[model samples]
Target: MRVIKLTIYEIIFIIVCITINLFKNGMGLERLLLPLIIIILFGNLFCKSNLEIKKNREFIYAFILVFFLYMSIQGYYDYTNVSKNNYSLFKALLIQLPITMTVFAAYIFGIKIKNFNWRISLTSLLLVLLVWLSIEILPIIRYVRLNSITDLIKLIIINIPIKIYYPSLVEEVIFRGLCFSGLLAIGLSEDKSNIIQAIVFGLIHILNYEQFSINIILLIVPQIYIGYLIGKIYINTKSLTPCIILHALLDSI
Candidate 1:
């Protein structure tokens, strides 16, 4: 299974050549404002869902309302927790809100939501509390190395479930759900579109930094491939269910 997954990952990796355009000014939201807005507008305009977007704005709004409420709670948590305050984990979740809420709203309205075999999304998220606590309480797990006071604190900080989940969902929807599927719907073939979208998703992380090192490329490699796998799982199963689980598991491991 590992080998097969790696071969498919390699094929997609080949379509992508690495070109690190370093940004020395440091990352900021302003950098992507115009382009990101344009993409959001375009996707909202043309996305083909089972719901009549114009007619179902109310449903969409309701979902966004709930989502925003959750986000507000997360933000409050961030304000209270010093480490979270530094990470802007709430703000990171906030950044992806507009699109993620839209996809979910569409799902609520009987869209062309895919039907998969295993049929589970957020199962991994459900396990997060257990996995995270295990990392703390258990001693044998390799990733659970509580070497120092600060390290232990960081482990607690990073392992927060809401910190992990909301952003992942937004990323999957924007990258795999919208960009990949939208491109495929227009003209790009499933594999090509997926691979390209995965590349873009991976690039978002690597390029957001000031300078892209070879190590950065290496770090992004597995993630990009995982993004590709999410794309493939969505396309092949014709559902978003597995993407969520696969992504959560990859991050968990």
Candidate 2:
């Protein structure tokens, strides 16, 4: 077998992505081991070669540039919010505008965006509904309590745009557009790239819990599955639109 060489940017890109997820919440030695171990195992499984990396150096550079720019803006927003204890629409816009522009540019450049296909779109939508009903609906029903129809409507109205733009659009762009497509562009097989991105997607949710435990680790399993499904949708449709819509609908619930 031929040896696969990774470019420096490729290594930095991978490290930055992992580091962002691992340390995003806070540094805790005890909380780090399990997720770190899992990440290592997944990395070994998926990132066994870098021939693709060498061939796709320009794409790697572009991906790194875009990812870092997004993170920098996001870091600024987070810093200002924490320091000032003020959450203003302007502050939020500072972050969202860059993300919106990045996603738009990504689509315009065809980085995971494809020509519209109604059959695939419809199938993707059906899959999204099935996922919501089977995996998400029960928990939502159990946990979400609303006072009245007006309140429900208000919540939906307020959350739909936020959920769609931020998490759905931002995450789909990063994981599907950058990570998954970047891997594929660099020569990884579709299966390996999908699993790796999905694992990273799931692992990042570790930050969502205040405290770590085996149970908290277990909860991320569903996220991995969801990420895998989203990756599959992107692969099938050759587009981010379905993936973004699916993610938005899921989060909106």
Candidate 3:
């Protein structure tokens, strides 16, 4: 029952995402199938959730707090930037608020930092690194050929803020923390929660890249697998710390 509700909610969430994307792209209703891949994955993996959100008031409040905090920061950034060049702060909020709120919701729901197992975490990190690198080997080689070691170092140094927020902290918290944890709390098994949330995580990247092409299509599988890896680490350690490190490193590389 609870699981059924969550599944329905997930489906509705996907629809909302698709609708938002269509509006953003100025596309028609017919192209909705492109994003339905996410729904398909969820439907195939659907299971009844026994966990209840009503019991999770603390999590909800935390999510709200984080969401507003992020929005405020982004609003400030937009205001400062736009003041310099007549930019539209409202437009920035319109574009980013949904995604930002979603990620923060996941962070509040999924992140539990009590148990820390360095051994298990390091092992998970290594495994995720291998998987990420293997899938990205071609790109890695191309990057190496294009940039000297110092250049790579400089790039990492310059993009530290970006790598931490976008790929590492925010992504991991949303996927592994909110999606995975919320599923678990709602009575889904660990494995089912991981796979379903992973698929959604991969699908959310559609918005991140702001393109709905075959490249994004090709990315779902790897992203799903990567999401599973991160969820697994979170499950083992009962913490988001390890997953955040692994996700950040994967994105940075």
Candidate 4:
């Protein structure tokens, strides 16, 4: 039975991330207390577990039931939305729900999906931040100057959660958690698994574009590198926490 542990830096980093987001959303001290308390309690419920439960018939059945329910809901939404010509970014996010549910199912079933370590989380975040600053900051600065502060803040606030939950959480759970791990489980070498998942991750982005073109190729090339970097992080750390947080930050900005 392995215990999930956090270092002081990791704990502080998590609290700071939550606090800044709350403050940005206009949560003052008086109103903040309750939400913060609730968040802490909710987080504890997930993090306090020893993750030692043995697999059994009941767990397997429950996993299948929940996974099917998630897929059904997602399928229904896609069918309804696409038929009405009302497919939105929000609706598109539903595509990720099945993968997200699969990750949750693994957690609930006491499968050791990944390790969460403080050093890995912190290092990953910092490295990604540096890369983002170098490559993405200029474009963001130009955009910021053209928009009102309030509008920019509103945009960030609205998009942060979507970015976090969608491409960040969902993609990592799929490529890194499922694809990478699944390959390793089948006795593939780590290098081979990492490369395969990264390529698949990049190839999947083709669905984002309407049709294949040179432009799509140009866009996907970067995504491949990004996927590779993220996959490498997962291989080294065996954790998705840093990948999700850093990927969300990149998309949000």
In model 4, which runs have C-alpha deviations exceeding 4 angstroms? 1-99, 102-123, 148-154, 212-219
lDDT of 3: 0.51
TM-score for every candidate vs. truth? 0.46, 0.59, 0.51, 0.55
Alpha-carbon lDDT of model 4? 0.55
Off by over 4 Å in 1: 1-141, 144-164, 212-219
lDDT of each: 0.46, 0.57, 0.51, 0.55
Name the 10 consecutive residues with the lowest summed lDDT in model 4: 46-55
C-alpha RMSD by candidate, in order: 12.8, 10.7, 10.8, 13.6
Candidate 2 lDDT by residue in tens digits, 1-253: 2232344543554454345435553423332333333333332222212222222323444555566566566556555554245667566665587766654444434443332222334544555555444445544554455355566557667877877778787777677767776787778877678778887778767656656787676667657656866675565456666677778766765
In model 1, the Cα lDDT at residue 248 comes to 51
By lDDT, who's the top model here? 2
Q: What digit string (tens of lDDT, one per residue) describes model 3 on residues 1-253? A: 1211234544554465455545554434433442233223332222213222222334434544554555455555545564336546455445444445455443444434331222333444454455445445555667879887687667656564455555466556545655565566567766677667777766655544445797575545445545755665565455565567667666775
Candidate that would win on TM-score: 2
Candidate 1 achieves a global lDDT of 0.46
Q: What is the lDDT of residue 163 in candidate 3?
A: 57
Model 3 weakest 10-residue run by lDDT: 46-55
Q: Judge candidate 3 at residue 69 and give its lDDT.
A: 57
lDDT of 1 by residue, 94-150 (tens): 654553454455454353334212243343233323322332233324344536656
TM-score order, best first, reads 2, 4, 3, 1
